[model samples]
Target: MATDYQSAISSTLQRIFGYDRLRPGQEAVISAVVAGRSAAAIFPTGSGKSLCYQLPALLLPHLTLVVSPLLALMQDQLSFLNSRGVAAASIDSAQSREEASAVMAGVRRGEIKVLMISVERLKNERFREFIAQVPISLMVIDEAHCISEWGHNFRPDYLKLPDYQRQFAIPQALLLTATATPQVIADMQTRFAIAADDVIMTGFYRANLNLLIEPVASDDKQHRLVEWLSPRLQEGQEQPSIVYVTQQQSAEQLATMLTHHGLNACAYHAGLPAETRDTIQHQFMAGEVACIVATIAFGMGIDKADIRNVVHFDLPKSVENYSQEIGRAGRDGRPSDCLVLANRDALNVLENFVYGDTPERDGIRRVLEEIAAVQDGSGECRWELMLTALSQHSNIRPLPLKTLLVQLELRGVIAPRFSYFAEYRFKYLRDPEALIAMFEGERQRFVQLIVETSNRARTWCSLDFDALYRRGLESGVNAERSRVVSALEYFNDKGWVVLESKRMTEVYAVTPTPLDIDALSDDLHGYFKSKEESEIARLNAMLALFESDTCLSHRLARYFGDMQAPERCGHCSVCHGHVARLPSPAPLPPLESQSFVELCDQIIERYQAAFEGQVPGVDLLTRYLCGITAPLFTRLKARQSKGFSRLEAYPYAEVRQWVSVHLTGDQ
Candidate 1:
């Protein structure tokens, strides 16, 4: 260990970042990374997790690769590092071919010490092939909790990161996340083969945020949201706020309602185009927008510290989600409000999302059979071919299919070659002949050769990089694909084309063994069912936090592995007597009443009626009436139907109760 390590960190913290000193837990994590050891740091939101990796990235001799889940997070961290004068660049789809090429060039030339990339890039065979040639000193996994099944936000892709580590032989790895329970912590350490002593956690307690939960009636949630937000919209009190919702439709409706009430508000979800979401986030961060009514997608990479309020208009899906979202507020160390309008009815809606993800045993069987059919005698199957065939043959969705794929990989029934390139598409911006004229002699010959190899003459065509490389071989150029990509990037920079590409999503080859397809498929179904149950339990834990009698912060701290939390923080809803006592709504208009049975019959009839050769199930109908989407409904093209959200304005509980009794017979 260098005795000057502390001095180095302190001087860098003060000189480069203008910080007084390293924040709590940062120095230790950074030390571990510097010493080529693995560590997991579970710092709370507003605490600087990036510094743990950023400082070491500078001191380390080789490039540090940061694998992040969200595009916004990568871009934001890249911008922050550049602002601090650190040479950082990210490989994101939003970047132009020229921009991505510039990043790749910088990494190869050692001009970029820190590189940020989405985990999805690992799915790109070409990228993985490219990374194999690079010398990487450190691997940083942000939002590391996503690796564990016990985590609130379990991303299947993060589970593959451990393999990437061994592939690159990355000596030093660090797992950075804001929220992780004790279970998630244990899982990360086990999966990454990390040491138990390497886990570093900071406190989750935030004194500046006043946590409040209002137990409003489902019908009154809208009014309560308005009541809380209207005052903030007043002159001189134009503090930015985020009202979290559960559904894309609700986000739009709520934002529209807010705007009609004279508030500058907008809705955000993945359903909106990427450009629109980016614009909304920018406006919100710039203070041009007062409020953003968003779903979970809106908060991940947003670093706005002065947000004065965070309100959960619908129930949050997990204790981790609640804590992380509310943590967005008061980041500037100023007092801010954290409010949740808890309604029991919202639980059914939240739980339905969990149920929607669990695929049937038959669906898992179909997926396995498809893969088996595609597998050659060598037990290898093209990942893209299988996925495409399965998608075309059945209505099984990506989420459930991904879970099954992960289950198969975990079971040793199949293995994923995560580095395979899937497909790449591009659109020409200028005339093809004119663009081709820019190249002459060898350049012109090679460009034409690559284009002829691609075989996609029209707009939105896929290119075979491997085939193109083969053509390059015939042209006596060893760096053929790189040259083609570089030329494409050059054209893009010159406004001749807009290029886009995606790596294949996890291709796997079947393992040779005594086969038990039935048993394996059943087990996969259980695996996904367990995931659903885990998510439901997480959601309940969030509600449990709201319902706790102790101080809200204390409960939150204890939930995130802080058993020593004080009984009284004196800043929560419980401490202030804002228990949010609720009055019961009128009984569900009598189960057999005209208002009840007709709505119930309508719900049953709408789902029982098939569309696109797929029948909607109880779970799908439940989500439909509850105003949420089940995975298959949209894929089956039923969402465009006239009655998809007939009961959208009603309480989820009311509709769910009637369906359970009348249609499902209470299961």
Candidate 2:
């Protein structure tokens, strides 16, 4: 049987992927699947992890269910599998109702050997019904770190998989990821209910990939990127590359700049229309676009193999994100470069980003004061912190707290930013033909405007209602706006168009519905305070990663719990030059002259009219006054100017601290 399996694997490799033999761990992972044993494979990025499960799904009689995190990844994998003559399908939000139903039917009938889906889809009652009827042989969770709160990318829905595992009674399962620290691994095992002996970890080392971090002044960083990239892209040797930025506008701007500099580049981010993103991704994969300038939203589930470089145009929020982003390089075993252009200003920008998004003390206190009344206060770990925070608003746990915490830490949010979904709706009056025919007066013009505004393309359209309403007012149709809106609403009710609205709410920590308000409140408060401290600690740790003169790889490895030699890699910027230190300033004596309330009132009045009477929380107001362009404040036109001209002389940190104390009544 083993010999037969090896022969099948070899034949599949040659016939399907045009490879001669399996990589190091592929055979073992395949063998475990063939034997019907649960297994976890921790291979480094670009190590051909997908083939481990894909090949077995082809050989086995049972259908394979692959739970993926991103819709783009699901589509890419399905496309690749179908191209290779394998029967595979994916169901995601992108799929039409008919398509999804057909896929479900195929799974139940054993016609589809592999079905790819997101974890959230599994929670759907209809999908659950179909899953119960299918004879699934293998269950795979790609990006398995999402199951752990400690993992850098946590998805709360992943925590619910164990229940599905029990329901399906799946004898074999595979949890695969390119990155996982020891804590993450342990958390995955606990969450997935995997046996300790089933875990297979390959050490994190990619000798062919040279990791380099260059600390330059903010303005010079772009110049260094251009210089490094130009040498690599000489006339006959343009390699596939990805340059990650934190902002969507930056992605577009950088892509345009790079294209002007003679690089074939395009921008990729979620902010663009879906079709545009799809076109750009396809072009990049086909080598039509030599480089892609993207926000962090661009690369989940991407399977492109010959990528030669991964450059960070802006610092990522966490070391895990940095590792994951850079891991996209050198997957084809060729020498690839991972470059990060860091500076003191970037650090400050990141810190301000963190401070700004953290829920204000009042919000934090509201939830914490409630949690402080709970009994689970002493026994709770970091995961409990997430659960309590989410439980404050809703009965259902919308997101896994553990995963959210990791994401917040990576994004430099001192606390979890409230998560919200976007919803939209459109309506039309009269029969479809009548509406098209009724364009005889202003009614006709309004109808034309609605059609033009809502007609996104052939299949679907997204109307920016705000923009449309403004256009209506500009055109002197302020009173007619109501009739137009009413028509759209009517069409939405008739199912001719979509009506959508999204709200952000807390994900509850418990499932059975808590009856003890006091206990829940106590637990919530304790978790909030603990998370606040943990976030601060994580930020300091990231700072230390930059400050160390040691090997970047070694520092990264140590952070992930690999106790290896600390010898300098000699490839990073720190090893090549002296590590720069931050300047220490003298501490100021306590301010005794002005009371907290008196000072806050003075500052509020000074900036009240400018800020529209509602002062943004302390940290935000401070960043604005200090002339810093933090992410949140940077979006507003009003905050950009030196409006707080009188307050410019005072230190921002002091003002922020003073305002915070007054707002919380701690002063």
Candidate 3:
């Protein structure tokens, strides 16, 4: 069996991918997948993780559904697959209605073997219904570590993958990640119901990387960076490099600084328009730009192999992040430099970001109160509220709000029903009478009535689902709402019409019981508090690794569950006796000083409407002042105010304590 599998995979590898053989860990993963068993491939970046699924996808009997985190990654993978003559397509927001419709038609016709989408796409009821009709042989979850809340970059939507798998009845699962600790591996195995023995991890040690952790004062980092890069700045002497910063402004400022110092550098961050970011990425990959200053968003889908330098202009969010970011370097078996200019200045801001995501107890309570009100039949179910409006009303950001809803679902408080668009709009490609004439019997009548009932515009027509549901029941055939949707989808598939769905509204049903709203609120708040503490612990652990006396490479390897790594790499800063602890930045201004207090007062007065006719809460105020955006702060555009982020350098706890004292008139 093994011989047969290898023979087939090898031929496919050479013929399609042009690779001589599978990478070290790829064969084991591909073998397991082809044998109809679930497995995980924990290979580092550029270790050919994509091939594990890409190869087997061709061999599978049914469609392979790939869930990726970013559209750029999907595009990259699709391009590679198409270049290799594979049947692949991606359904993302970037595609036009005609394009998406064409892709769906291709999938239905068995012309597309693999489909890539964001995890959020699973929430679309129409898409889910469409997919349920297709047979999915396997589901591949890229960045599988995001499924665990304990992971460094936990995405709430990722938590739904296991359920989605069960919902879709996918026969096999493939979990892939570049960085996963033992704990994260355990979490993934348990969540996906894969046997521990099926997990294959290529260890995290990269011998070709020269890891350097340099502790420098915040004020001197710019000059130090220039000095470090000076040798590589000679004409045509620079290699492709990535300098990572924590914030968008830092990426912009540092890129400007480097360009002034004579390096062709560009900044990439989520704040830039998508087209601009794509252009910058293309330039960087083409060697037109020698260096790119970016936040964490830049490296996910990058496949460049000769990147010689990976510098941390700011401390990474966690050790896991550091490992993953540095893994992008030296992918072609060449020596590359990985540097971290460690300092304490950004610690407050990083910590503040963690604190900001945990909703305030009052906010949680208010949300629970809203739920309770809905339970009493006086208002709409909290789920029925469009997420943006709910966020603005409850003062919870969308991501954290989603987490809270997930928590509620886990506790049996509510369950999400199929979400639906409030209205379906379409533009006709064929005349209504002509299209209706193509059908016969009750179907022809249904199509004719659909056209007659639509609210028409010059070039478009709209159908309200509620009204459609009623008319469907009253039609001569007594058609169901599902039938109406099916007709529209069928028309779309046939290219008779171009359909667009808008105003998606999610539905949920609350489970009735003798409920205690206060207790539930406390429990949910505790969950967020626990998450906040866990995040802070991760940051502290990264700091400890930076300040450790052990070899940087070995320590990193061990942190990611590579126990066999040697005790010393003999090339790191610590190995050379150059270790230094990060220096703390100067203290922030006193919160109780007259001027500071007055500034706080002015801010409170200016944004009092966000407080909802009550005194500003300490947690909310501290979050606002520290540049952490809450729903209310965002809705009020507090980021535009000078007072926002005024005390961002101060510790969140300290700021909260001071705000507590002052707001209560105890200062």
- Cα TM-score per model: 0.83, 0.70, 0.88
Ranking by TM-score: 3, 1, 2
| Model 1 pairs in collision | 125-419, 125-420, 125-421, 422-504
Candidate 2 — which residues are off by over 4 angstroms? 1-18, 59-61, 235-237, 256-265, 352-514, 528-539, 561-656, 664-667
Best by lDDT: 3
Residue ranges of candidate 1 with Cα displaced over 4 Å? 271-276, 379-383, 386-389, 416-507, 512-514, 580-586, 589-667
On TM-score, the candidate that comes out on top is: 3
Write the residue-wise lDDT of candidate 1 on 1-667 in tens digits: 4667777777778878898877888888988777778998899887999999988888888999999988778877888899999999889877866678788999999999998888878877678888888999989999998888888778887888898999888887899999998888888998787787779987788878999988888777887788888888775669999999888999999999999888889999989998899899999999889899999888887889899999998878888888889989989999999998877765555665675566766667767776667655564556444454464445456666665676677677776564433556667777667766778887777767755766565456567778777777778754455566667667767877776655444556676564577987777777777887788678767767888777888989988888766778788999997765443444544434434344445444544564443444554555665556544555445466545656654554566676666555774
Over 4 Å off, model 3: 108-111, 376-383, 420-504, 589-597, 603-613, 634-643, 664-667
lDDT of 3: 0.86
TM-score of 3: 0.88
1-667 per-residue lDDT for model 3 (tens digits): 8788778888898999998977788999999999899999998789989999999999889999999998879999999999999999999987765688899999999989999999988877779888988999999999999999989788887988888899889988999998998889999999998987789988888889988999999889999999998776566887889999998999999999999998788999999998999899999888888899999999998989999999998999999999999999999989999999998988998998899789888888877776676675544344575777777787888889999988787787777777766668899999998998998988887887788778889999988656655776787565566777778877987889998887667777776554587888888899999999989999998999999888988998888898877799887889888786998998656666635465466557756765666667788778877888887876567787767888888889988887777778555
What TM-score, to 2 decimals, does candidate 1 have?
A: 0.83
* Residue range 94-174, candidate 2, lDDT tens digits: 665557778888877888999998987764555777798888888899998877645666676676677688788776788
Q: What lDDT would each prediction earn against the true structure?
A: 0.77, 0.66, 0.86
